[model samples]
Target: METSTFVKEIAERFSVINRLHPTELLLPLLREIAKGSPVSRKTLATVLDWPADRVAAALDQVPSTEYDDDGNIVGYGLTLRETPHTFEIDGQRLYTWCALDVLIFPALLGRSAYVSSRCPTTGEEVSLTVAPDGLHRLEPASAVVSLVRPNASSDIRCSFCCHVHFFASAAAADDWVAQHEGA
Candidate 1:
């Protein structure tokens, strides 16, 4: 398959897996699952293939964490809810918006609830608010600004999260804020 097609497919899968599991073990879990599936392993290893011994070694290394008891091979992954669906590198990136809450806060100084940039964990933009003592944890962007109500007038797409807040550089975020003051 073409690289972009594969990447997009992987990204979609990652977003699914991430809904259940945390991000740290996403790749390892992917490798473990890939090893068993007939086409899944072959397709993934086609480009990002690893040596057989290396794959075995990595699989062995995956269970070393202290959180879950390491007895069954099938258990112990990035699960937050039930058994986790392992994610590949692409999956990890797809779920990154879920993890980058604090990272995107600076860009979210002035945000709205309806915009796609709100954090899923908090259901709002991760923003600083005045506390009785001083600055504390952030509130979701939604709490700050009401989202534009969906209506027949606008074409709205539902996504896992609203706006994405990745940065090539912090200076770039600064530039973005400077250029789009009310955006």
Candidate 2:
């Protein structure tokens, strides 16, 4: 598929996932998580100005929400924990579940980010600055992002996010795409 087509498809699939949950709360929750700290339910409720029970119920609809030992949210799509994809904003280091999250979150949070991730095949680092408007300072100009169609019934983190990655170049991703059989 063409690059634009692939991007559109991936975006659409994620949009579907978003529609399955309460985005009114999810978007703000994501912004809070992006602050590079684990967010407690009480804190989230206060920040959102919603009831604690309402916050708890909304959180239940979001899958793959990583929590700290104290039950504080550490990650959803954007996270405080370490991952292959590193996203830095406002001098704070953070992570994302996948390469696309690095691209997607900037617009969602209305902020720019410096991103770095290793190519799964070449083990070479792929780095870039992504703004709410577009990508910038992408090293290795030929760098590309890998994507997969997510299975709606499965956990998005495992089925889709884990497979999506940054590649140093198209050639570096060819073997991985071949092995994955539909990326």
Candidate 2 Cα outliers beyond 4 Å, as residue runs: 1-12
Write down the lDDT of every candidate, Cα atoms only. 0.32, 0.87
Name the regions of candidate 1 deviating beyond 4 angstroms: 1-39, 63-98, 101-122, 125-183
How far residue 39's Cα lies from its native spot in candidate 2, in Å, is 0.4
Instruction: For residues 27-122, write the lDDT of model 2, one tens digit per residue.
Output: 778888887789999999999899999988888877788999999999988989899999999899999999989998899899999999999888
Residue pairs in collision within model 1? 14-91, 114-147, 116-162, 116-163, 117-162, 117-163, 124-140, 124-141, 125-140, 125-141
Worst 10 residues of 2 by lDDT: 150-159
Clash pairs detected, candidate 2: none
> What is the TM-score of each predicted model, taking all chains together?
0.22, 0.90
Model 1 local distance difference test score:
0.32
Per-residue lDDT tens digits of candidate 1, residues 122-177? Answer: 33333333222333444432233212112221111112222224332344345444
